[model samples]
Target: MAGGNGLLEVRIAVPAKDASRIARLLVEERLAACAQVVPGMTSTFRWDGEVTTAEEQLILAKTHRSRFEEILDRVGEAHPYETPEIIAVPIVEASAAYAAWLVDEVAAGERP
Candidate 1:
């Protein structure tokens, strides 16, 4: 429908406490076909004027280019970070069945 055979893997880093809620939001809105949350990651970064570290969770959302924008907007609203890390990496390769399934799933919720 909206996207082609092309796919994307969107990565969003969120606070550990909000991980599950964010995952459910993406899947429920169908901005993502699936979202896998990986926790227990120690992230080090510069905040304010000092370097800091915190435990965070990573949300890997499987979707397509068609849904990337929506994912960004929705995650921005749902995320706590002033600037959430939202990155989309093109999926260069995937099994035929899996790719097709991914497109179909994401397309279902896309607006006309």
Candidate 2:
């Protein structure tokens, strides 16, 4: 289900050092209304038949679904991982204030 604004909450994982950079870039570019970086997370998965564990920081971005592609492109440009974790989950419901703010933030960048 998608809301009127077609908003999405994007999640991406990166090294602790890069978390701030990624979050800042998305906000600075106005691709997201807000970005929250949570640290001290461990992820375990199998790669090439071998299980691996990683220490990662989680980046949560709020933006419209329309900007999902651009968000991925910007994040990839700075992500060190060959395959960075980029996922967007639709926002089925949101308060009117938040929805409006999100739409305005991602529609276009601010002019100086």
Candidate 3:
């Protein structure tokens, strides 16, 4: 079993249309233990030398660090953005039960 301390909670921002689709796929593929889709996010940024704003959805994915690259690959293939926003934040602390459950749920039937 992979260690939980190395786990991460990844955040990816995608257009609202693709949030549910990508989130479901990630969880179903076991790349993410759980995915939370937050809608109605307004993003303001500079693009093409002009400031622009757009409505987007945020996907928060929980998974072991060992699967980071795999998660990235999946997101890249599934995302609609030309350069999707993919960011990861390490979980310094988490409920042991939740962490364990996350590992179990994301595994192919393995338990930690």
Best by lDDT: 1
lDDT of 2 by residue, 5-104 (tens): 5888999999998999999999999989999999999999888899999999999999987788888888999999988999998888888888888889
Off by over 4 Å in 2: 1-4, 110-112
What TM-score would each prediction reach against the true structure?
0.93, 0.91, 0.88
- Candidate with more favorable, higher lDDT: 2 or 3: 2
In each prediction, how many residue pairs overlap at the backbone (N, C-alpha, C within less than 3 A)?
0, 0, 0
Per-residue accuracy of model 3 over 30-93 as CA lDDT, tens digit each: 9899999999999998888999899999999998877888889989999988788999998878
Lowest summed-lDDT stretch of 10 residues in model 1? 1-10
Our model 1 lands, by Cα RMSD against the true structure, at 2.7
Q: Worst ten-residue run, lDDT, model 2? A: 1-10
Compare candidates 1 and 2 on TM-score and give the better one.
1
Q: Residue 84 deviation, candidate 3, in Å?
A: 0.3
Q: What is the C-alpha RMSD of each candidate to the true structure, in Å?
A: 2.7, 2.6, 3.4
Give residue 62's lDDT in candidate 1 (0 to 100): 95
Local lDDT at 95 for model 2: 85
lDDT of 3: 0.87
